[model samples]
Target chain A: MSKTPIRLTVNGLPHEVAVEPRRTLADALRDDCGLTGTHLGCEHGVCGACTVLLDGEAVRACLHFAIQADGHAIRTVEGLAAPDGSLNPLQRAFWENHGLQCGFCTPGFLMLATWMLEQPGPVDEARLRHVLSSNLCRCTGYQNILTAVRTAAQELGKWREGATPA
Target chain B: MKCPPFDYHAPRSQAEALALLARHGEEGKILAGGQSLVPTMAFRLARPASLIDINRIAELDTCRAEANRLRIGALARHARFERPVVPGPTGALLARAAEHIAHAPIRTRGTFCGSLAHADPASEWCCIALALGAEMRVLREGGERLVPAADWFQAVFTTALGPDELLAEASLPILGPDWRCGFAEFNRRAGDFALAMAVTALRLDVAGHVAEARIALGGVAGTPVLAREAAASLLGAPPTPDRLRAAAALAAEGFEPTEDAQVPADYRRDLVRAMTRRALEGSLAA
Candidate 1:
């Protein structure tokens, strides 16, 4: 089959690339565009290592075809921080709470947690745990990860309120 | 991993999509949300010679209610279920089901049609559709038809859809007033496919008599199944714990589930009961 040419938006920049009919978005991002922060774990959809935001929602990059993403915007782990390269609030909280160990699964967790915080209401622990269950961590530091989300949610709420002013 | 090579066709309209499918026949696969189909492609399980991506067809995503039925265009995003095309009891319950599906992201990209058409027995949509007695509208080269959830789902990983036919839309009967619904199941992890799942809908008459009761269980059977005998056992009675237990016991009467690592059949059998009991209690709790 002939290679299919497609354009992908990554980290706020558009890049053109020609891919085989079925190269997964994960492989194209890591190997073709050279965005290495996105890890590959199960190579199946089960592991969240290849997690990325496809149009602001978390999805398994490994399970998606690169050509299928034409005209879509994607955000990976590398985009989490400030444009000036300062640590994002979530990254700072994760560090403060020791939310990650071994760090293999941190990117996926970061993406998942970031997306979850943007959701409209108070995210209780049970709800947060249920959302995080899809992402597996070999480090087994779930308690810390849970702590980080709580901290981030509180911090985020305060930050938003402060920005709005009385 | 790379998926097997295949020519891609992006159909801009429903007519074009129908034409493409009819011409390609069984060799073409319709791409809706790609939440499940893409993964299967990576695994080399389903390699269609041609892929017709229907994302550009704006009409298929439209949702509106006509008369007593809600017409959800097949390509409607899963997130659309969170709101009402028509304000009613059934729409409210469907919103709840949409929230529990996979996760925030999956729901955003996954379409209502793709989820049902993918027909994973463990899917919440399948169970909800069955429990609510929803109907599907499908289109072929020269014809269209309606298939109820009961008739639509035939077996594990299979639907009654013809290869050249496209699911145009789904029609759901708006649940009437006095209806109560409770959905419950446990997956090994959140957003994972359910090890076993159940959705219960109950309606009580003016005198507190159970007027209508519908129960569906998934992941424990080949399809999202309506517990017929179980429903028969509770018809016209007060939906009490004892009646719920009797209905729950009938879950194992018709089918046997296969053993997988996350959950064995014996465990699923127990979960089916627990979920049924809790679902009934929770529905009544409302």
Candidate 2:
């Protein structure tokens, strides 16, 4: 198949690229755009390894096409931390609370955690658990992960010293 | 490593999209968020000659509140409902159901139309839509048609949708003030399909009496199945624990769940009882 023209703003940077119809967004991001922070595990969307934010929401990049994104804004784990390689508060909270175990599913978990924290109004623990249950983490069993989310909620709206490059 | 060779088309408007579908017929597939379609393509499960990306069509991405119902376009993603128009128990039950679908990322991109159109018996949206008595609007090249929840879903991964038809929109009647709603489902893992699921909507007057009740079950049947006889058990009765228990038992008695990783058919029937009872209690509390 011939390559299709795709123009998308990925990780805060706009890129105009050519992709075949067969390629998925995960392959496009890592191969065409050189952003490898997003890992591909379980090419099927069962695992959270390939999660990324498309237009400010988390979606399985492996299950989407590059050309399909077209004019949408896409964000990856690489876009979450500060531009200076500094850790965002959610990252620090994860580190402090030992949220990760093997770390393969860490990026997806972090992206989901960050998004959930941004949601407005009543954040009950049970409700929060139900919300986060969609993204799977095989290694850590989610106990520590839940702890990190709880700890982060306790320190809500307390940003670190300088803002990260959004 | 990737999906098979196929043509990609993005129509600017709904008319253009319908034209594309009308032309391609069975060889074309409507892409709604691609949550289900892309995977179906990657695995070669559904090999359409052309994958028409309908997400770009402006008219398909809307959540409009009609005079007496909520009209959701086919491309409206699941995550859009987290912050709903109306809030409270019984009010905006669909929004609450949308939240529990997949993960935040899937919910963010997975359209409820896609979820329901995908026709997964394990999905919460299908069961919830049926329990709420929603109407699915399907548009064809010649004309349009409306399929109620009962008629829309047929069997596993099957619906009444035809080859050249596109699911245009789904309209659900907004819950009244006297209604109480509850949703309960059990899944082994967070994002995986449910082993057994149940949803209930009840309307009670100021005297706290049961005026109407609707109960539906997913994951335990050929399609999103409704337990109407069980619901009838609650009709014309007060909202008491004994009455609720009897109704829940009737609901459970009717379900014939299949054996799978989650549980045996017998256990799922028992689970139906527990889930239905708990759902009733929760709805009453709301």
A1-166: candidate 1 lDDT, tens digit per residue: 5777899999899979888867888888998889999888987677788889888878888877788788899999998898898998889989999999899999989988888887777676666766787688898998898778778888887223222111
Clashing pairs in 2: A58-B105, B79-B107
lDDT, candidate 2, B21-103, per-residue tens: 99999999888877777777778888899977888888898888778788989888887786765554434676666666776
The local lDDT score (0 to 100) that residue B264 gets in candidate 2 is: 72
lDDT of 2: 0.81
Best by lDDT: 1
- Best candidate according to TM-score: 1
Off by over 4 Å in 2: A81-84, A92-102, A120-132, A141-166, B87-90, B205-208
lDDT, candidate 1, B83-157, per-residue tens: 655676778767867766776666767888888899998888889888987889999878889899889898888
Q: Model 2 misses residue B253 by how many Å?
A: 1.8
